[model samples]
Target: MRRPDAQAREILALAVPALGALVVEPLFLLTDTAIVGALGTDSLAGLGLASAVLSTLVGLFVVLAYGTTASVARRLGAGDRAGAIGVGLDGTWLALVAGLVVAAVGAASAPTVATVFGAAPGATDEAAVYLGISFLGIPAMLVVLAATGVLRGLQDTRTPLVVATVGFTCNALLSYLLTHGPGPLPGLGIAGSAWGTVVAQLLMATWLVALVVRGAQRYAVPLRPHARGIRLAAVAGVPLLLRTVTLRVALLVTTWVAAGTGGESLAAHQVVFTVWTFGAFALDALAIAAQALTGRNLGAGDAAGARRTTRRMVRWGIGGGVVFGVLLAAGSPWLPALFSDDGTVRAAVTAGLLVVGLTAPLAGYVFVLDGVLIGAGDGRYLAVAGLWALLGYLPLVAVVPLAGLTGTTGLVALWVAFAGGFMAARALTLGLRERSGRWLVLGSD
Candidate 1:
């Protein structure tokens, strides 16, 4: 085999650590699910609904990460380190405010949010409890997101990888201890899991904030939030927020459909969806790399480098997806056992896993292209493209229930519409945009 090219080496340098960070990000949820799953089917299903709502809320603000990454990387590439840090600081401040507002609202309306998914009464109550406590962690979560973007843009994915690894470890230890009974520390059921995760998130956020602050001070960048800077950051994030909202809505709808199918099916779908999300984030490691590298290249006016990087990363993305798909397919028989004890739930999860495995490659393609556009600061196009993709997804999902399917068969149909139809729609839209070559604009905008 030939030696790796310079661009390939560069990509790996960023992507490898980024992979660790991204993969660990989802492990937080996966761990919580595994722990809370022991509480029984209703609890598992409830956590599913709460997780869906919480993720959607956090995901809508993903611009805190993606937007900051692009802006910081561009400025850094243009040799304005101080300016880059300033943008990241602005994002962090915005995250704090947004998180506070969302937490207050989400906590107050926990039952309303939980019931919207239509899970069983027991599951709904459990979901509400989890949601109420979990909302308190949103600020830390968003802070971590914005701060991680800063590090990634600064070409320091290793810091995030290390911090996330430690955080996940803390979450796992705490989740196990709190979720289960031990001496005086009695178990709090799903609430215990929520508290554990929140504490771990707070720790991670503290570490990240300190790091960003130190970086800002080193660059002589002001730590205080500037009105104009914060406003500009928010303005820049709106389109990305729209893009993220459409994506989140699609997921929320999927959870709603799963909820309507019955508790067993909902529980199974929850496990499978968590695994699918884990795989998605695994693939998104490459996307994160693309965001950093592409923005940097364009900021340096090296459009050719950006093009070459994109081409190379696309191949890597597909290859990574193939590996993950194979793993998902191969593990389907045994994977569900780890999450639930119900035979029906296990069977449903196995079927869902197969569907997710089949669609993994398509997801890889869609995600990388998405990162490329976002890195180019082409959020406007992305927002429109996301809408088109969501429209395609809604009709296909609608057809699932309209067909009058139920039980395992219904779950399979829903997964097909989601894994197959939704991902395919995303691929089509992103591919068109990539082929047009319009996102390769130079300089920090």
Candidate 2:
């Protein structure tokens, strides 16, 4: 048989599972919204508030995964297989420690945070209950995040995708059964949703650990503790961590501002944002692919190859964006009904979908460029660019209300500003850096 072409195979290896995992994330959240919306508007609102808070918090630790993946990819490119394993193990420890801290803080401050989000009086209690339960599973969640990052770094997106699919499937089944109280199952309401996620996290974490243990024989280095390595890893990772946290706080604040508008406004914002995220995640797989290919090429001292690969991926990302955007626009009316039956919510979501459709293709460039930067081991630039984006949020917030665009219109405008501005800055920075060819000179080790 004729050998398959390298680029074609590489694209498939990265894109397929990455897209599946991304799609699955929205499916899980959509499922939650559907189940909770059936309970009542209050239940739906509470779940939305809870999710906004949780997602922000989780986004903070998500840096660990991102940083870990970049570092491991560099090591792999450098042919330091032992170093890659060490980085992965150290990242696992870091994620666990960080998760514990988050759990403690989340448990103690769930009520206060929920209140700050302006959750309705009745919704606050439900939000608090759900947040508290979800916090307990933070450690497991972090482990899975770290493991998935490591796998991606090793150019193995398929395994993480499989694990995530299993976890999400289980979560949906348990959540539906418990929340609706089918047969002998007692209805636990909103809390049942949180329980489903927690249980799934535990299962996914366990499976990841087992897989890592079994696969260790393939690594050049043994997966063991490295107490002395913490300082170096911490130093390399701290800036990225802070950057992630800052960006996450910005998002949390944006949600808080939306809440100040009204419940329907917040709900509408959440639905549109969720749909936007689907496109973001789908394109991000390409970004991940770019990161891997670029990092590997850089490590091999192939600057031309890296540049070519990045350009190709950017085209692919944009194409995916256009396709998904058209699909989202076509289904604008039907999409909101997937979340809520409320006519107001449906109308708001449908109105916003047009802007979402137009902006998504533009937004795809940002995702692809982000992957290129990360793969280049350009974390500092990522951090700085994010800070720049955060600064833009304030102006968008002030302008939204002044113009009398309260609901989805304001939200879509804000996202467009975010995606457009960040991509411009990132492109300039990366373009300059790539032209200088300094990235090629940097040692992966």
Candidate 3:
């Protein structure tokens, strides 16, 4: 058995690289935002609308990564590297098919989606253009998701991190050159930005696919998709997909409630929510480590090892939460200034950040436990638990708008419902399940 210190080392090994890989997505969005914002308000608003759609489409399919990771890691731990590779191939193939379907749907619905977002006519036009072009990358995007899952399951976070970094650099350079053009090159405007992203995604996807194919070849795993394997993969992914969709609903509802609270409140909520999201990136890295390690342990039929790793990872989550909470709280006074100059907005942001800071530890605990169960292939429970949490959250959020809370007070009320109420609900459900020991089932089922 590995000592506690050794287990800590193992957790960090995966968590650090996972953190780097996770940030690349946000950076990609920010780069696009910066370059496209220069084109005009219409372009920027269009990008926002298009991005929201693209994110939803891609985000819903994230199970390709999480589901694949758990499946692959379990097989690897059972000393079946070839079987793991085969399972990974199945996941990759599933991603391709799913991606193609989503891209086609997205392309067909771009105009309607943009109109539904209710942006101005010019913005809607720009959004349609961006969305139409961006849909081309959906297949590539999902492939990257699945391929990254395979690597992470194999305990290879470093490769994804490297690939993501290169992808981001390419995205930034290409977006700029294509958006604004240089020398003899005429700018394609918003179209250029979309094309740049598509090209970069294709490059990244191609690279990741090649790597997975090489692994498959090395292990003598057949590259062709088995119907049974693909069916099982889809079956396994459904629960996780439900869990993810439920969580997304919770966030969207939160934002929707915030919007009803008045402009100042809404502005403040966005800033604080953004901060919370950034904080989540750090906490989620620990969860990623938990997922990989827990899956590997249980795959080897080492329930004791899984428990120990879970315990150790839980502590790390708590520690991480405390550190981030303190930072957020300490920076609250000035953090708002960075995001806005309005005194009212800044004050509201500060109040919200304080509450977020207080709940950060709870967030940490919930995130890690969620990852552990995922590694255990206990998605059914996670899906049900997510609904329970959302149910708990809805009434609490409804009260803010019903009571007509406004200004900084309304913003504070919203966060209390979100960070305090919603998060506590999540913590309760996840903690109960973690303590039940039911998720400790062994093997690669």
Candidate 4:
């Protein structure tokens, strides 16, 4: 195949499964919403708050996956298959250690976290219960992420998709049985929902390990414990980990601010965030594609190919975002009701959706640029750019309410500032890096 044709084919092969894996993630949230919604508004609200808090905390460790994908991709491109596998093994061990730390912290601090989020008096107990149980799954969840990162770095997306599909299916089934009390299982309510997710994540982690151990595919990296390998991975991964941790903390602050606004506002924010996540995940498929392709092109010393791939990925990301935004805008009125039956809840969500629709395309570009920089191993820029953007975000979030902007308008304004600032910084960094050919040169070296 011609070079362009080969690149396109490779991107598509990776993107389709990346998209599937991305889609399955939100399905977990959507499923929780559906099952919890049947109980009461309070149940849904409590779960939403708990999830936001927990996700923010655990998401800090996402660097294990993100850093691994880029580093391993670079190794694979350098024709170091064994080295790539070794990286994956090291990541798995690191994930186990990180997950244990998070789970211990989460279990011990669930009540404090939930209370800080302004959980309603009656909902606090339930939120704590759910979070406590869910914390147990952290190890499995991180393992899945680490394994998938390895596969994606090697341009093997299909395995992750298949694994995710199986896991999601298991989650849905377990959710139905445990939450609703079918057959011999007693109804565990929200705790049951947490357990379902934990079980599903365990299944995913197991499947991924099985694939690697069984040598199911050429890309499957065998798992072998190497203390030295783990140490090296940790050193290489710390910068990215710091970046991830800071970003999650920022998001946690954002969530805390939203929760402080009111339960209704928090619910509305969650709805908007959920919808936005769906669109973001779809665009993230393209982002992951860009990350893989960019890494590969750079690995092969093809600067022009990397540049073209970055441009094409951005185009795809923006297009997907626009389409999702339009759909979200059109469906705003009805979409909120799906999450909650409360009239007040619906109204708040409707308002939030309007803001989401307006800014999603910009948000899409931000996500795409992130992938590009990551693939280029330009993590220092990510940390710097995020700090700059938060300088804009903190002030806007603080002033919006004080300036008399209320409800959705105020929230949307905050997101606009965030999306706009981040995108501009990322664009500038990428532009400068491209013009200087620094990233290309570094990759070649």
lDDT per prediction?
Answer: 0.89, 0.75, 0.92, 0.75
363: Cα error in model 4, Å? 2.7
Report residue 169 deviation for candidate 2 (angstroms): 1.9
**Model 3, 1-445: lDDT tens per residue?**
8565777788989999999988887999999999999999999999999998888877789889999999999999999999888999999999998889988998998888889977699999999999999998999999999999999999999999999999999999999999999879789999999999999999999999999999999988999989999999999999999999988998999899889988887999999989899889999998888888889999999999999999988988988899999999999889899988889899999999999999999899989999999999999999999999999999999998899888888888889998889889988989999999999988976
lDDT of 4 by residue, 300-355 (tens): 67778788888877777777778878988899989888999878778878877777
Clash pairs for candidate 1: none
Q: Mind giving the per-residue lDDT tens digits that candidate 2 earns over 258-376?
A: 66556776788788777777677778889878777777677666778787887778788778889988998899979889989888878777866777787677667777877777777
Error of 2 at 364 (Å): 1.8
The sequence of per-residue lDDT tens digits that candidate 1 reaches over residues 1-114 is 999988888888888999888778778888999999999999999999998777777677778999999999999888899999999999899889888988899889998989
Ranking by lDDT: 3, 1, 2, 4
Q: Between 2 and 3, whose TM-score is larger?
A: 3
Which pairs clash in the backbone of model 2?
none
What TM-score against the true fold does each predicted structure earn? 0.87, 0.85, 0.98, 0.85
Worst ten in a row by lDDT for model 3: 1-10
